[model samples]
Target: MTAPKANAMKKTTKPAGAVRPKLAQEGFFGRSGYFFARALANLRQNVFVSVVTVGTISLALLIAALFLLVYVNLEGLANGWSDKVQITAYFDKEPAPLAVAALKTTVKSIPGTKSVTFISKQEAESRLRARLKGQESLLEGVNADVLPASLEIRLDREHRDNFAVTHYVAALKKVQGIGEVQYGEEWVQRFNTFMNFFRLMGLLLGSFLTIAVLFIVSNTIKLTIYARKEELELLSLVGATRFFIKAPFLIEGVLQGALGALLSLLALAGCYFAFLHNAGSFLGVNPAGAGLSFLSPLHLAVILGGGVLLGFIGSLTSLRRFVNV
Candidate 1:
């Protein structure tokens, strides 16, 4: 070869000895620039696929959040109902005033007793009369003595559940003068059962929903990543590190997860407001009075973090499996 031709060859060719120095001079950004740039370019090229994946993930998260919202509100309502739980003990006959006073003190000594009010036969008769105000004729022949004197037992705020109330009732029955105990046992049991069922449903539904979310969203992510399978394979062939190959995908996953979670939260907020606005018409009670609330701060954080994590995992793990990179 002539001198000019040899010089041209030397300029055109990169020596093995100079490659490391060249890469070192470029530093971190230089070494990863094309991989990062191309990754971004691929994302731009596949906007439709990216959007579909985000939409799928958002819908899944929205559903889970909605369930949580309902569960929280229902739990609040159940707690309110539990708070109203009362146990009433009826006496066979009207006790003497002193006897009633002694009995009230004895009942008050029970562990969970908050307050005990003695209703004399006359007071009980008066209550019945007040209840039947519009039908006074029904009480024409009724006598005050017919109504049994009773102790109206209101339990402590924390111990109003059926079990506590039953235990209190047993303690009351053990009192010498106290008679039969009637505390709407069936109602309390049913309410507790319903509340328990609601909690259980929340657990089961949440589990199933999470599994469903992972399954469906994973498949969507798979398709999105699979669309760039050939590109990823080419990058691998060119000796790109796995980290570099996966960076763009990880970024895409995090973005999708975050955006989807935000949108779902927005949707949930809209639902909450809509429910509150129309609640009075259907339920006849103001939700404001009942103290309905949204998720706590911790819950919100968990959701946001969960979204980002879900996206990251989906990108990192699924990308590898989908493209076999």
Candidate 2:
């Protein structure tokens, strides 16, 4: 009788930890499947609200993306333009060819100067004629000797801002036989100031738009929670864990955000193509010359990631109230 009693006790205890492993396995699989099904059902049930929420997010993301694209291309264009921007230092008269070559070498040695090319008097005259094509007769009397030989100095990118390049050029004012250093100093200064103002405005607008998006998403999620309050309460009263309750809604939010991002990207692509077709000529972006590139795969990934993060954050914020209650 004692041996039988001990055997029965061991039998009962044997299933305790053994059952836990099986239950844990079942729980993981069961919860995952339930979460997926619930998320799909929720999306279908709240189709109208989902659409509105997605559309709003899409629009906001689209505007932000467009600005980002513009900013990237503008930076590229500015860098290209900087390389083209050069100062022409004109000599007093027709210096000897050897002296001009020596001056060119000296100017090229300057820290900011990338390249220096000497434009001879005759070449300068020819360029002037080409520029004033219709008025060639007006310049026929002037001799090549009258046109001064000049050194065209291309500066480094760092020196392209404001009067940095100008100051560097001014240092060569007393160089032998150099008459004057000419560049668009005033125009460059004004352009830099304008770019600064534009960047500041963009920053402010981006910040406001981001806040507005967060507010909209948070409110939408709160509404979703309110509509499903009864179901959540019932689940809580039962044996459903907090993670099990929240998983479905979190998945739904992610789906909404991903769809929104994809739709916005498609819309943006269409708009960009249309703009390129209609206004390519006016914009000076040649169709054949390395035309404008759309968002790369990496950028698309970033957009999708950003969308998912926003959705998760909004859902989490709304879920906090339910958790506390």
Candidate 3:
């Protein structure tokens, strides 16, 4: 009996060194791997729910991306038009090269001025002729000197507002070489009004769309959680912490968002390519000349981030509503 008891003790008393490998294997990374595997299994087992969730996310992101593309392009076009709304200050006389150079420097030194380009009389005439198109023959007897040499001053973004432009015009009139200042006051005011309205509408519309997407994603994710009710209940019964129970769902949400965003991007690229291919006939300009542009990398990143956040929030909201944990 003593010998038998000793053997039993030896069998039960494994060395500390022998137990360490098991502990190490079940550390943070190991647990994370388990959660990851479980999440993937959940996704695979509920194929219909996963597809529906992904599809819903993809559709939402697509709509968002389309609106984003429109907003970006409209903003770009508005900025371009604003840059073209220059202040043309005519020179009283044909100044020497040094005088022209000095005037250019002076114009550039102004606080709101983006750039100053001196347009010689000849270049001005050429521009007029180009504008005239076939009517240029009507000006056969007109002298080039009738046109004025001017400094075209483009304003910086902050200074493109009506009040700023008015102030800049007043300041330019006081400069020594400026014979006359010309800018369309009414036109500037109208442009500013349109820009303000455009921005306001974009903001309201974007907010509505974003909320709609969030709701759709939340509902879709709720379905996914409902499908895994048994698994979640079993985990909870087994003393799994709330964070541990919720983490896999959060990861699933993020995965859905990331994949959805990628799908949207790919779809957008296809549309862009299609647009380029058909742009000439539809828009009267080829892609190169159409002034169409895709979103910048920074903008794309923002879209991806927005999708991820939307997913995370949707998942959190759904879980709170449905799972009780």
Candidate whose lDDT is highest? 3
Q: Which ranges in model 3 have alpha carbons more than 4 Å from their true place?
A: 1-30, 93-97, 120-147, 321-325
lDDT of 1 by residue, 28-51 (tens): 466566656665676688889877
Tens digits of per-residue lDDT for model 3, 28-65 = 46688877877788778878887888888888988888
Query: Model 3: how far is 131 from its true place, Å?
Result: 6.1
Q: Estimate each model's TM-score.
A: 0.73, 0.75, 0.81
lDDT of 2: 0.76
Arranged by lDDT, best first: 3, 1, 2
Q: All candidates' lDDT scores?
A: 0.78, 0.76, 0.82
Per-residue C-alpha lDDT of model 2 across residues 1-325, encoded as one tens digit per residue? 6999989988777654555444534454666877888889988998887887788778877877787666655555555555657788988887787687788777877778888888999999899989999988899779888888888888887777776776787777768889888887776777678667766877887788778777876787778777778878888888777787788888888888888788888887888787844444677666334335576788878888877877777777777777543
lDDT of 3: 0.82
Candidates' RMSD to native = 5.0, 6.2, 5.2
**Candidate 1 at residue 290, lDDT?**
54
Candidate 3 clash pair list:
none
RMSD of 2: 6.2
Residue 8 in candidate 1 has what lDDT? 98
